[model samples]
Target: MRDARPAALGVRPAALGVATATTILLAGCSAPVQLPDPPVDDATRALCTALVADAPATLLGSPRRATTGSLAVAWGDPPITLACGLPQPAGLTPTSQCLEVNGVGWWSQDGVTGTVFTTVGRAAYVQVGVPNSYGNTGDALAELASVVADHDTLLRPCVG
Candidate 1:
């Protein structure tokens, strides 16, 4: 019986090998990272788009992942995700601990899963969901402060 491989079908063996290798390489390189798309109003959506465009390529020292069609960004394998235009945090109070970093205010609330930090007093709320493993929420918030400030209007400042 004659050979019945790709070469026997008038295709070069080297070309077939290269094509298979290229396919595998492209597949490995093009994996998409999934992230949550927080719902927002039209005004907030516009602000979120601006924030996303200004977001840094890295967060907490990890390379920013390519998020799948969301007004959000992530870093690391199980990423530290930041979703903009979230509804105002229900837990915020007059006395809630707020920190100012690079002229932006953040209200932080700790939960079992992780620490949630929201930009306080901004016209549109931007939330950063930092996992417990991250250890330093401050750095992530600091990195994001300018982007949030540039895109959203401050309604009030963090009080002492």
Candidate 2:
């Protein structure tokens, strides 16, 4: 008597098991991200590249994610992102509250998305965008300030 199994379904049971296992293994894998590149001039671009390259491996106990194009980095699942070579904040004024972290001066503002801190009095403006989930923007800025100061020249110190 001829076998009743369909010829099209001839795949070995072992092969099917292997394929299922492979799929299960890959299900939890996450692809690395590339953030939107902000506009930057030649001078600023150079500084940005240097800053990204020198950024620490971890910030606030979150591992750094791979990034490309202009200067950008992210950490943690919610992802605290930092972008360099951005335009200076137009709203910034002499009276704008400035905070010094790790010897770098930053103008901090809370936005709907999160708290944004921009380097003040630096050769190139750098912005750090911390999601509201992070909760501690000060620590993030403190960890990042050294990297910013390494790449950009400080024009003036934070006043008041």
Candidate 3:
């Protein structure tokens, strides 16, 4: 992503040159993508609970938010990107998928069949999908189970 600064900010030519060079220089560095704060909702909250229960340490113990019909979870560490085939629109091979617990899409376009986890704000996202390999459903199931565990935290305990 390119950072577009205003050209009419009274920036002198020398300053603009410096800014442009600085931008280029910064772009060379691998900077983690930033996402907006996530919103809390019933569904997302439930999901969070399940995730925590499944694997408390897997998640960086950060608050999460709901966004665009999905729960967003961010991480305290640098987000990870992988080729996870998340459900997408039919016939549209998504360039990539991004997951952030705090309601932010954090996936990037890469030609691999793996899952990518991302973090936005204080939350993180763990994505699951079908892999290009065979007979690995057990692994997938285990991953899903871990994610489902967080749901326990997302939802209020049933009155019993």
Candidate 4:
């Protein structure tokens, strides 16, 4: 008997095989990055929205990617993720020393996975997490410094 499997399925044999292969290949691909959406007050949200809108289209040579949260933005594979309107970090005490970049104050704390730098003494809190693979946070922070300073109100200046 002649093969009628493709005809019964209403598709050509070659097309059916191609479609199956495409699906299998796509299944192995990863999804877009999803940033956490932390709770923020109304004023903070407004500031974050403005900052996000004015944020750079590219960072650290990587084109910006669409992130899941409104108050967050990311760039590149192994993304450098930025989240705004975060609560004050416990480590940010009166004595905490921070890096001053483009007039923006950032507190840097390194972890096993990566280094997380959060803006200190701003009206609205902003956090940027740079993975270890990215080498260092300097370039990333410098790129973002002006944008963060322009949008987020500086409550207290950071020291170098």
Query: Cα lDDT of all candidates, in order?
Result: 0.67, 0.67, 0.30, 0.71
User: How well does model 2 score by local distance difference test?
Assistant: 0.67
Off by over 4 Å in 2: 1-34
What TM-score goes with each of the models? 0.73, 0.74, 0.26, 0.78
Model 1 stretches with alpha carbons more than 4 Å out: 1-34
Worst 10 residues of 1 by lDDT: 1-10
Candidate 3, after superposition: displacement of residue 144 in Å? 3.9
**What is the per-residue lDDT of model 2 for residues 28-143, given as tens digits with 9 covering 90 to 100?**
35333335466667888888888888998999898886544447776665556677776556678768888899899888766554677778888977777676767778989989
Question: Highest TM-score, which number?
Answer: 4
> Residue-wise lDDT of candidate 1 within 41-102, one digit each (tens)?
88888888888888999887888876664677766644566777666666676677789988
Total backbone collisions for each predicted model:
0, 0, 34, 0
Q: What's the lDDT for residue 153 in model 3?
A: 28
lDDT of 4 by residue, 1-160 (tens): 1211111111224645554344224323433445546778888889999999888999889888766679888776566778888777665776688888878888877654467788888898788877677886799999998899899998888854
Candidate 3 — which residues are off by over 4 angstroms?
1-40, 56-126, 129-140, 146-160
Scanning candidate 3 in windows of ten residues, the lowest lDDT window is 1-10
Backbone clash pairs for candidate 2 read none
